[model samples]
Target: MNQNQSFRQLWISQSIANLGDSFYILAIVTFIYNRTGSAAFAGLFPILRVCAQAISGLAAPLLMDRLRLGTLLWMAEMGQTICFGSMCILYFFLPSQWLIPAVLFLVFAISMLHGWAIPVRNALVPRLVPSHLLVKANSLLATSDQIVLLVGWSLGGILVAEWGVIRVLEITAIMMFFSTLALLFVKDPSANVSAQPESQKRWDRMKEGWITIWGNPILRTLSYMEIISGLGESIWAGSIILVFVKEVLHKGEDWWGFINASNFAGTILGGLLIWKLSKKIENRMLFTMLISSFSIGVLTIAFTYSSNPWFALGVALIMGPPYQARSIAQRTLLQFHTPEVLLPKVFAAFGTILFVTFGFSVLLMGWMADQWGIRFVYMSTAGLYVLSAFLTLMMMKKASRSIQTQKEERYMNKIE
Candidate 1:
């Protein structure tokens, strides 16, 4: 198939897989809580999943170096499908004492495979689309992601209640099967077309991405920004948000859901705005990213101080566009700056950083919420955002000066 067809297949596969993921996660969390009657047990699901994904990301360069991106993606989906299908069977046959552990193991296994899929899929976009279309492509992908999250989570709970957990798992398995099938048509000629030298050590291959990030000034700066932002973004974690709704807003579970939905809606709007302004944004990615970063910092503070539920909802909605803009710009910048051969590994390293930071940040933010207040957790996150923005500004100036030096050297060579 042609590049356009391949890209379409990739997009469809991701959308379907994400929808299945939503159902699968909701089913598993609900099942665990219902069976155990413990919020702590249910919470372990995310904790385990994050840890597993981080571990997998750290090792993903090994696979990315050997397999085509298309192959890696489809295999990840297939592995998830098999794991979920097995979970459905084990639910019926396994003894009560063994079932939760079995299910949790399967969850971790599935998440490990997912860790590989994310970087592979992201690395495929630059190969499929021209550089000029990178912003629009990333915007479309982000929009679909938000849409899937909104639809899947909004409908998943109801579906689980109606269909029962086992049936929902079965349906998700089927959806994943189709996602794998769609991925079968995807082609990424840029990946794994040649064998690596036998002299390269496995340890060296694994650390290659981290080395690349360290050597590149832009990637290093971006990594620092992501680390800071990831910590700040943890304030949006469900547990923190739920607590804020209860303790600060004096609101019910429905209000929590409303706030979440509003945030999703705002992100969807933001994605559309980015898509519409893709050309302009493409030319000034750093500037756009900087502005969006500051906007999010300001909006987040506004969100933290609002006692009125409706006002908080509005602030959450306003937060979406800048958030989307910054995300697309960052992603596009990474794609443009990294070489095709190294992009997947670089993305893997970046994913690992995010996973690690987010995991720690969740725990840190949870403690702050308990010790101080939910408002304090958000206020501190806003401070982190401001720090992140200034860092980006510094990086931009350094990059500009580097470019000027290059131009002047070329002019001197011409004069000689």
Candidate 2:
């Protein structure tokens, strides 16, 4: 098939997967909340699921070769189907806590599949489209994903409330199954690897990935960067609903609709703008710092005491556009620096790193908010973002040197 054809297929597949995710998030959160009737308890469900995902993320990249990308994704769809089924079918007979572990396991399994898919999926796109078009493609993906986020969250719970949690789960599963059909036409690119016998031990395979990042200061730096970003992100996540519904502004459950759609708008716009602006820029790292600082710093103030419902929603819409711009810069750096096959393992490592760092912060932020004033929590979070920005500068310095070294090596190879 032609390059455009290839890209269109991949893009559609990604959109399908994202739409399913939107529905899945809607179904799971709404179902849990209805079953339990407590916000804290509803939140607990995702926490367990995230924990499971975090654990599986560590091993997922190592196991990527267990199947081709097409097959891996197909199996993921199957897992989603089973996961949804377990939720609805088991709910009829199972106890509350039982659903907790079962759904947790299913989500974790889904995450593991995601771990395998992300790097390969990311790596595949550049081959399908020209380099110049990649930013645009990514932006498109980011935008749609967020748009769907708004829709899914708004309707997902209402469906559960009126129909049943089991019905919601079942519908999401069907959505997932339909999404999988989109993958059938996806062009399987060459697996990003050099053919070698399967002799490496799993521990050692994982270790080599670690050692590669550790040995390369730039990759090591990105690792830490991902951790910090993920952590600060978790704070906003864990607190947003509570802060919005109770502390900052109250719109009842409709608050979720506003928050999700607006935040998604920010992300979508960010992605779109990045696509446009990336070619004009050279010092992406510095530009990234400036834009991301705006995002993180703004959150600090926005959550300081809580504002009007409309005001917060407006803030998100304003913020969404820059989200992808900042995100794309980071992704470009990672993609440029790494080769193809190793991308999965590196990303898996990144996921593991993300979960541990962010997971700890989620627990920490939740506890702190419980004990201290939410206003104080906002101030503390602002400080965290500033600290992270400073650390990025430090990491960037070392990364710059590595880039120079790589250029020198490339230049010397030309002479040879």
Candidate 3:
């Protein structure tokens, strides 16, 4: 297949996988809660998944170095499918005393395999599309992702309600199987294994991405922003949002759903808007990102003060465009700045940081909400975003210079 066809396959495969993921998450969480009758046990689902993914991410670079990106992705998808299929059978036949543990183990296993999916997908984008189309491609993928999240989560719970947990799991497995098949058509032009000095240590290979990220000013700045933003974004967690609806808005579960739906809708709109303006925004990505971060920070603060659910929904809706714009800008910049061969490792290193921050921030935000209030949690998140914006501002010159240097190097190579 040509690069364009491969990209289409990649996009379709990822969308399908993401939809399946939403269903799988809802099914397992509901299944666990119903079986155990404990919210704490149910909550362990995300925690375990995050921890497993983080671990997997730290080790993912080693695999990325050896395998073709396409090979790694399909294998990861297939592994997840196998794990989910196993969980379905065990859930039916396992003894009562052993069911929860067995299912939880499978969840961890599946998540570990899934850790490779995002970084690999991000790495593959640059290889598939020309540099000029990177922003458009990223925006398109982001739009599809939001649509999947909106449709999948909205429908997933209902499907679980109507068809039951096992049926949802079965459906997810089938989707995943097809996702794997779609991946088979993708050709990795940069599939050659990266050679290392024979005497190099395994530790050096693992740390290569981290070193590259830290050494590059743009990537370093981006990493700093990611850490700060990850902490702030934890407020969007379902538990936190649920508390916000109940305590601040004095609203019901339906309002929580409404608010979440509004956010997704806004994001889809934002993605489309960005997609259309991608060419205009490409050269100004950093500036656009900074502005978007500031907008999100201000809007999030505004959201915290709203007692009326309608006003809060408006705030949530308005926040989506900036959020989506910021996300796409950041992703495109990462792809633009990093070498394609090292993209997987850079993404893996970046993913590990995100998982760690998100895991920690979730717990920290929960504690802050418990102690101060749900509003306080969001206010704190806003503060983090503002801090991130300032950090970006401080590094803007250096990032620009780095971009200039990279362009010069590329030009020189072409001339030679």
| Clashes (N, CA, C under 3 Å) per candidate | 0, 6, 0
Compared with the true structure, all predictions reach lDDT values of 0.91, 0.66, 0.91
TM-score of 1: 0.97
lDDT of 1 at 223: 93
lDDT digits (tens) for residues 15-84 of candidate 3? 9999999999999999999999999999999999999999888888788877889999999999998988
Error of 1 at 31 (Å): 0.9
Off by over 4 Å in 3: 399-416
Please say which candidate is ahead in TM-score: 2 or 3.
Answer: 3
**Cα lDDT of model 2 by residue, 1-416, tens digit:** 57677667666766666666766776677666766788987777667656766766666655565666556656666666666666677777877778767766676677666555565566666666666666566666666666666667666657867886667677777776676676676665656352335886777766655776788766877776676677667645736455545665756766765676667767867766666675664356555755575567676577565567777777766756545565666666666677666665666677777777877887777777778856666677667667766766776676688799999999999999
Where is the poorest 10-residue window by lDDT in model 3? 191-200
Answer with 2 or 3, whichever has the higher lDDT. 3
- Write the residue-wise lDDT of candidate 1 on 1-416 in tens digits: 48889999999999999999999999999999999999999999999999999999999988877788888898999999999999989988999999999999999999999999999999999999888989999999999999999999989999999999999999999999999999888888674822457588988888888998999988998999889868977877899999999998999989999999999999999999999999999989999888988998899889988999999999999998988898899989989898888999999999999999999999999999999989999989888878878888987898899999999999999999
lDDT of 3 at 2: 95
lDDT at residue 337 of model 3 (Cα atoms): 89
Candidate 1 vs candidate 2: which has greater lDDT? 1
Query: Using Cα atoms with residue i matched to residue i, what is each candidate's TM-score against the true structure?
Result: 0.97, 0.83, 0.95
